[model samples]
Target: MKKVLVLAEARDGQLRNVSLEALAAASTLADGGEVTAAVFGSNAAELAATLGQHGASTVYTADHSALAQYTPDAYTQALVQLIELANPDAVVLGHTAIGRDVAPRVAARLGYGLVSDVTSLEAGEVFVRPIYAGKAIQQRKFVDGKTFVTIRPNNIAIGAADASKTATVVPVELEIKDLRSIVKEVVRKTSGKVDLSEAKVIISGGRGVKSAEGFNTLNELADVLGAAVGASRGACDADYCDYSMQIGQTGKVVTPDLYIACGISGAIQHLAGMSSSKVIVAINKDPEAPIFQVADYGIVGDLFEVVPLLTAEFKKVLV
Candidate 1:
């Protein structure tokens, strides 16, 4: 029997969906044993019930001033203590920015091997991770000792929520102190738009969009669908969009439910990032654009004319 522990990550006082997805992965890792969770900082307890609904039998919360905002020092300290208390066979985390930075510290401090960006679990023990820009997948497993894993969001299927199941909430005292950095304030890039990494639908522009003004058309469509806007590396390199919105081999890897590629030529690097999307829609004037190869739906047209038409049509259907 295996016991799994998941770090229930919260952002802006709200629980992140990836944390629940990680809980789903934890259930798989548990292998007929128990699944537990932990949330840190202010109002941590409030998030415990959600973890419970997602399959966590017990939820541990650690509240501390140092943990109010994410700092590696404070979170690492809290998680280390939580690990000691849970003594779980496996530790699972979402592969978000905070998880990426802190999971390594926890593994190193505990002298455990860590697996990052795990995409799938096979045969109960083998973990699958995409490598070399999705050109290949590597299967990994723990030889001995506690297992530490960080799962890529949207890859794992979140299990059914059981409202009947409730977790026992426990408070773990934290001694977090002497943080090297504290976030004074968070400056958001988008004005309350959906977070790109977790968005269910994504509309991405490419260099073929011509200019930053072209993105405005895409943004309009994104707003209509309540989706997030992304860009190909070519678009960012051409100064058509911010690097933050870039999606390619060196940029963000996204696996949304629907991915619309507008004016993208489908460079291999760009495909590396978004090829795994559930449904891909590619719109381009060129019939032979490489983007068509992976697209579930393809439209051959001028985006300037096509995008507005799509936006108008979608608005009628959606709202």
Candidate 2:
């Protein structure tokens, strides 16, 4: 039987949600095969147990000080060794920052095929992914010996957990080599309600918002709905908001449950980021705004008047 491997990511003993989703995908792929997960951290055993609940049968742990920091070389070496030992038919990973860096190198090292940012996976290893910045969808077939795939966050629903199951932990033997790049310092913004990519719901603004103060209205709505804030490329380019908040082809791609676009004339680039959302609501005074074409719900009215009303109504209902 072919074996499926899931690369798990952990931070301070807490497992990343994407890892569980990958496990779920692995479980589906492991119908007649074995499913396993691998992690590199101190408490990887506990993380392996959690991964088992999602369907991993075995877990490989590689704990070391060099593995603590996310250096591409260290992670690639660890995963390369694990893959060499396990020799799984397929390896599943989250299309996250770390995975994006390491997955390709691992594939190249093993002379394996890779499909990145996959939104859907099939039993036969057929995959679906976005192209041209989500403007078009592409279905791809993997006709190779071994395959590596990365799952886009929020695109796949996480399966129910089975806590009764536990994965066998296998420790990996690795020798760290001095790499070219070193992480000097890690700095994070202290003020933020949620990470845009991880947010379940998001409220985004655009050039029509007029000024930086326009984000205030969107924030009110986001607070009422407990959603993260987003901005369009136009707003970011105009210096109305930071580049981090921009959602477009060149920016972050998000697949939240609910996406609300305010004062935004949806361009194709902007739609690429949030178009995969389950529910899309657009508020624009222009009836012909491209946003309406994709929005499940559209309100043709000034955002200044419409957003406050929606915020008030949401606060009243939820509170």
Candidate 3:
């Protein structure tokens, strides 16, 4: 029986979907042993019931003013204390921005083997992860001490919520004394918009978008589908979109359920970030565009016309 500890992720005073997904993964890895979830943030204790419904048997919360915003040094310190107290066999986290930063620090401090961006788990020990910008997958196993892993969101199916289930919530008190960095304020680019990494559907544009005004059509389609908007590096470089919206080797990685590439030529760098999407749709006038190779569905046309048609159709269906 494996004892697993999952680090629950939350943002804007609400739990992130990947946090529950990580809990589900932890439950599977536990294999009938025990699954504990650790949440850190201001008022994070309120999320205990939700975590329990997903699969956590016990929830540890570190709620303090210092933890309200994410800072690498502070988060790592909190996790280090939790790990020392629980002494779990394995520690799991979602491969989000915070997890990517803090997981490595905790692993190094605790002398644990770290596996980042794992996509699959087999027989509780073997883990599968992508290599070389998702060109290949490699399966790895930790031969020794505690295993620390960060799972990619959307790859693993989330467990069903059982409202009848409940977890024992434990409040952990830690003396977080860090003198290095702190987030005094957060400036958001697309505030209140769907997080690109966690969105189920996404609509992205590329250099073919021509200008910033071209993104309006994609945004309309995204609004109809309740999807996030993204852009290729070429689009950002061309000043057609913001760099925060860039999706590629140099930008954010995404794995939405339905990824619509509008006017994107599908450069290798662009594909490296979103190829893991479950279903890809490419819309471009160039029939020989590289994105069509990986797309489940392809449309050879101008996105300015294609996108409005898609948006109208989706609005009708959604309404």
Candidate that scores best on TM-score: 3
- Tens digit of per-residue lDDT, candidate 1, span 1-319: 8999999888778888889899988888888899999998789999988899999999998888888888898889888988988899889999988989999999999987899999888875899999988888999988788978999888898888889999999988877777788888877765468778788899999987999999999999999999999999889889888888988888888999999999999999999999989999999999999999999999999999999999999999999
Q: Compose the digit string of candidate 3's lDDT tens values, residues 1-319.
A: 8899999988877889888889888988889999999998767789999999998988999987778888988888899999999889999999999999999999998899899998888884789999999999999988878889999988888999999999999999988995498889999877368999899999999988999999998988888888999999999999988899999999989999999999999999999999999999999999999999999999999999999998888888996
Instruction: For candidate 2, write residues 1-319 as lDDT tens digits.
Output: 5689999887556887888888877776666799999988778776777887888888999988788778998898888889889989999999888889999999999988898998887767678998987778898887658888898888777988887988888888788787877677777541368678768999999998999988999998888888899999999899888888988888889999999999999999999888999999999999999999999999999999999999999988997
lDDT of each: 0.90, 0.87, 0.91
lDDT of 3: 0.91
Clashing pairs in 1: none
After superposition, which runs of candidate 1 have C-alpha atoms over 4 Å from their true positions?
A: none
Candidate 1, residue 54: the lDDT equals: 92
The global Cα lDDT (0 to 1) of model 2 is 0.87
- Worst lDDT run of 10 residues, candidate 3, spans 188-197
> Pairing residues by index, what is the TM-score of model 3?
0.98
What lDDT score goes with residue 24 in model 1? 85
Q: Relative to the unseen true structure, what is the C-alpha lDDT of residue 234 in candidate 3, on a scale of 0 to 100?
A: 94
Which should have the higher TM-score, number 1 or number 2? Answer: 1
Q: Pick the candidate with the highest lDDT.
A: 3
Model 3 regions more than 4 Å off: none
